[model samples]
Target: MINTILVTDDNVLDNAIIRNYLYKERYNIVSALNGREALELLESRNIDLILLDMVMPVMDGYEFMKVFSKTPFYKEIPIIVTSSLDGVENIEKILEYDVFDYIIKPLDHINRLILVNKIKTAVKHRNLISDLNKATKIIDTLSTTKNI
Candidate 1:
């Protein structure tokens, strides 16, 4: 199945590059200019992962994560932070939001490969969690029916 990825970055060029790379991998790309727009997209899109940029005009990554984490349904979606901020403090701050991975940009070929690998890993983990949830629900229903 093609997973939908939400790329949230203020830089149009960054978004274009990421979309171009992921397109080759057959993943559906959804671009957002800022965290607010990303939140709006999340309301309608079935996003499997988020590629977030820390600095943006409106509602930066930190603010986005604060709002997003409060959302129970969305909290499970894996987020990979892509930012130019390489400071350890910056990374630690973002990590507090529980992102799946943090990647520093400009995405060179090696960084792109890392991004793709991380995406693949996150998608697999999400799928496994989904399958487990389904199994647990089925078991619960069977147990309920047996009791009845």
Candidate 2:
């Protein structure tokens, strides 16, 4: 299960609600008022999952994702895009980003739980894969040294 979360949104009420819910659920929560703030915090913190907002005053989600993609570390962090815009056009807009999940605004509690669980499962799988990769690399190095 993911212990930490990064929530990025410009709406104070939205942020508070999400924070309160996650807090009640006993999950660690970190928040950013806008994409720019989120990015700065992201640079310093290794969070388990991201809940991103699409529209903001400075540095929207799409732009943030574009810049985030350039950083190798950000690639592995799963992002769940949250936006008030649920129309086909908006969904289509963010589809290219390959976000782990999408949540429409007025964030439903059950839907939020679903997203949380999905992130937990994904994070667990990621850890397993990372461990396996490390083991494989070690084995390969040992085999090569033995043959030398």
Candidate 3:
């Protein structure tokens, strides 16, 4: 079960909006004003997913993704990027970081639903993949023993 979600956006209003929406869904919402703050939270929290905003002060989304991906602790945490920028180049840049989904700013009713569902799906997929990896390791160990 996904227990924690980290919301990283420089905009204070945006953080409030995201918190309001996600709080209703009973998720433990952790808010950060910038990527630097978000990184600190990740070091201390078990965040299951991240809602990342593209533009920010101190550290932007792109830079954050670059740094975050290099670490094994929270590298696989699913990220759904929230951006006001809409362009092919911007999207391509985000895609390079392996984000699970990209949501444009000013999320409406439909977009909210979609975002919620996407978070649920991403968490589920991560859990499934973890289980598969553990099973594979067990199988490999058993096979080695059988050959002995």
- The lDDT for every candidate, in the order shown, is 0.93, 0.82, 0.88
In what order do the candidates fall by lDDT, top score first? 1, 3, 2
CA shift at 99, candidate 1, in angstroms?
0.6
Instruction: Per model, state how many residue pairs clash.
Output: 0, 0, 0
Residue 12 CA displacement from its true place in model 2, Å: 1.2
Q: Write model 2 residue lDDT over 54-141, tens digit each, in one string.
A: 9988899988989888888777678888788899989998988888878787768787777667656766655676678799999999
**Per-model TM-score on C-alpha atoms:** 0.96, 0.83, 0.87
Q: Of the candidates numbered 1 and 2, which has the greater lDDT value?
A: 1
Misplaced by over 4 Å in model 2 are: 140-148
Q: Which stretches of candidate 1 lie over 4 Å from their true place?
A: none
Which one wins on lDDT?
A: 1
Looking at model 3, residue 42 earns an lDDT score of 95
In model 3, the clashing pairs are none
* Candidate 3, 46-80: lDDT as tens digits: 88889999899999999899999999877668999
Compared with the true structure, the alpha-carbon lDDT of candidate 3 equals 0.88
Strongest candidate by TM-score: 1
* Tens digits of per-residue lDDT for model 1, 67-119: 99999999679999999999989989999999999999999999999998998
Error of 2 at 94 (Å): 0.6
